[model samples]
Target: MTSQFPNTLTPKMVEGIKGFNLCTFLIGLEGWRRGLTLKYYSDINQYSDIHTQGKKLMGRNYSLQSKDKIHYFNQSRGDMVSNEAVRIAQSKQKTKDYLEKGNVNILPSKEFDKTHSDVDIIKLAREIGYPVIIKPTYGSLSKGVMLNLKNDSELTDALKYVRGQLGYSNVILERYFEGADIRVYVVNNVAVAALRREPPKVTGDGESSIEKLINEKNESRKDNPYLAARPIKIDKELKDVLRKNNYKLSSILENGKTIMVKNKSTLTQGVDLYDITDTVPEHVKQLAIDTLNALPNIIHGSIDMLFDGEEAVVLEVNASANISMHMFPTEGQPRSIASFLMDFYFPETKGKSSNHTNMYFDFVDIVNTLKQNYTNYVEVKSLPQPPLYAKKYIVTGEVQNVGYRNWIRRQATKRELHGYTKNLKNGNVVVVVASHEKEKVDKFKRVCKKGSKKSKVSDVKSSDWTKEIKMGFEIKDNITKKKKEVDKKYINELLTELKETQTKLENAKKMQEELRMERDSYKDKLSSIRNSTSWRVTEPVRVIGGLLKGKTKVKN
Candidate 1:
């Protein structure tokens, strides 16, 4: 995920803010930055509910709180949505029924069960028509979905795999939509973000194969926080699409040629999501809002639709839709979906805090402690406002590799400071410490003068540091001045030692083989001598002679 969008985080702020956590943290942090307290918890006891601080929370769910209000969320779903609405959204057939009852335009479609025969399915298909999509009745994220079935054969194969192989007993069939796949995020009857799910594609340079082009595209995409989470996989479906076009990943395309890499476009399909919040027509956004409004207890979410030039058709509505895509699109201006969510939830906090802020909590630690079962919930310290106290101390003298950095790290950690100590090339160590408390920063500066036992600090120069300070204390061995000649010499030494050892082992093995051959030859000669007729006759005579010599003792 190559990141084209601007990053406001500390250069190396906590990672693990990807996947589901990406959306979860974005939405949670958006509110928390507005002077709200945020807490993330696990549902260890799924059947248990919680009453903390006199408020009855459904469970140990993730929540954002203020003095007067607190909103609990199960993933992306907030307390505003009812369980009924959630249930309806979970089922495609039920969602269709709800939307139709609300007079929202739906594509001609029908749901079927396992009882429906192939003939019956074909009959209904003829009535509704060909070139349709067949998907599980309760599928999400494009799983068990077959798009654009042109005839009975295509539909049959799709059904066989999605139903028979995948074990989805119920399915819905709908007309093949001709348009871009668009999702409009609606909140409080207002359109917030609209994104077009573009299929994975590549433009040829007339130099590289399609595979190489895709690799290059991926190289750029891997830096993005959202797009890089799940890279575009070259799977069977993508191969099939290429084969259909008389091409393969290895086939080099003509310069300036662009082709869609896959047929289906969705998050599951590694679609290149583009934020088109501005370009999507006002009507399309309105339709999204209207469709969202039609559902009961559903105030906000993403409405999936397909839009041709003239018409837009609602496909489905996602209740707990992730806002990550909107926040970080592969291309186009990133939409501030978080602000919209915060505005809906805490209207009074609008503009109270700038959205262009860098106040982020330790998302990685909280998630980790939960997984370790350290506790059910880890309440992240609501990050304070910007312009935190920062200080820098460059300790000159016997600081490098003398446990000086580790000692400083311990001191900083004890004081709960945020920053790092790194070794410099000039036999000095740079220690940067930051915190919300000025006294803590000043005390750390004083402590830098007194390093580890072995360190002989000549002078400790202190100054105010203005750079972004990361969330935790660390000792960094950050020298990048590589000694290529020294590395080559070391490698040569190792190779020489290894080659000598290998030769010695090989010679030893050869000697062992020679000894084994000699032993085998002697044993073969002895067996031949024993098996001969003369040796058998001599054996009795030799035994008689031995008895004669021992006659006195044997009394024979």
Candidate 2:
């Protein structure tokens, strides 16, 4: 089985696994947990090389020299999809052509270049009928897509926006189909999951204004992992959508009424996903599988369609990267598409099952790895080198007292590299790395330059030093005796200050208790005096004296 699939890894998978790219991380985590050795190169120094030779690294780019062959993945999509398949699927016009050729029911669409006049484009839409959709020829995540163009003015405006605003030279106009937006994820010509993507909407509560309702709806989505990053915006598009429904930002809607706020059903635009896998018709599943089979060398991807009653029309096919709708549907059982992908990559482990909780890599480990070596931008390419190499590095600038040593140690251990990271007296970090693979060593140096999240690394100087370092990596205690003495003095000073504070606190408590006792004694003495027989006898004499004084004053 190892000989059949072969071990593989991608740079994107390594760097992205540490960051917010959940799709890439899920696939990489699944592969790592399944016992496949993964290697990646994401240092800034290698960016130029990767950028220049990116095309050559496509489709089974490198083979891992493992004893057993294990299939590797790029992003979450495995080797099942080919470079050609991704290219064709990226273009809307090209995808429509292939679907039509496969006898699939796709909406009639016409491709137009920027040179086409508004008259020509509007004329084409008229022929296709009113309520046509205009979108960029090549795009994803529903960017630059306009729907429900019911007039020449609307079509003309959409063309300008797609061309002028979006800067897309090529655009496609298609007949608009009204139905529930559905997506079917297929793996190896088998439908594994289905989702119904509904446009972002807010239900009216009868009293609150439309804007207030939208705010409430967005607030509810703030805690969702997927929805938090992509909230509905009150932009021009949203305003237009509301206006079309005879509403505005200030409109107070009737109770139970719901209005769609966006034209396209994209998850990034707050679209809701409903898992319809079990309830989806067999014919619909077959159609999704057939759509993938229609494309050459495409075994895994999603088929987007519009379904009305029992009939479904193909909207588009995405092979470049699979959307994560199945993993976190808003209204249905969340599916583990990551596990499914791992099963496809490593077929030998299909029957072997583990606890569901153990299937994912540790989140803390992933975060630490990211903090050590991850950058916001990572390209999908490979580094040109053998499995093992060695290097020594001197990382300067804010590298001390920031947990940099522990971060580098964890990074080396995760990559199975032998290296030592220690703090120098000069406030620099020195690292000696030796790995069986050169890419691993390169990645280590890159991570050192980035340092931990708390450390600010100014520069990283590297040199070849395989001959000097021994096997296994450890953090060497290189602090001088003088520095240790200084540390001890600082600790003593803190201890003295703490003791003084404690004594002051105790003194304050004692004074408070004494004050309370003195006040209570005074109260007791006053009560005793008031209750005495002498006081009672003096009360009657005082009253007689007061009356005599009053009588003398009246006579005077």
Tell me, by TM-score, which candidate is best: 1
lDDT (CA) per prediction: 0.79, 0.70
Give model 2's TM-score versus the native structure.
Answer: 0.60
lDDT of 2 at 260: 88
Give each model's clash number. Answer: 9, 7
The reply for model 2, stretches above 4 Å from the true place, is 1-20, 43-67, 351-556
Candidate 2, residues 165-257, lDDT tens digits: the string is 889888888999888889888887678889888888888889999899888877876544455567788899899888887899999989999
In the range 75-115, model 1's lDDT, one tens digit per residue, is: 56677887778888889999998899888988989898989
For each candidate in turn, the TM-score is: 0.78, 0.60
Q: For model 2, which pairs clash? A: 2-69, 6-70, 7-70, 387-436, 387-437, 388-436, 388-437
Top-lDDT structure, candidate number? 1
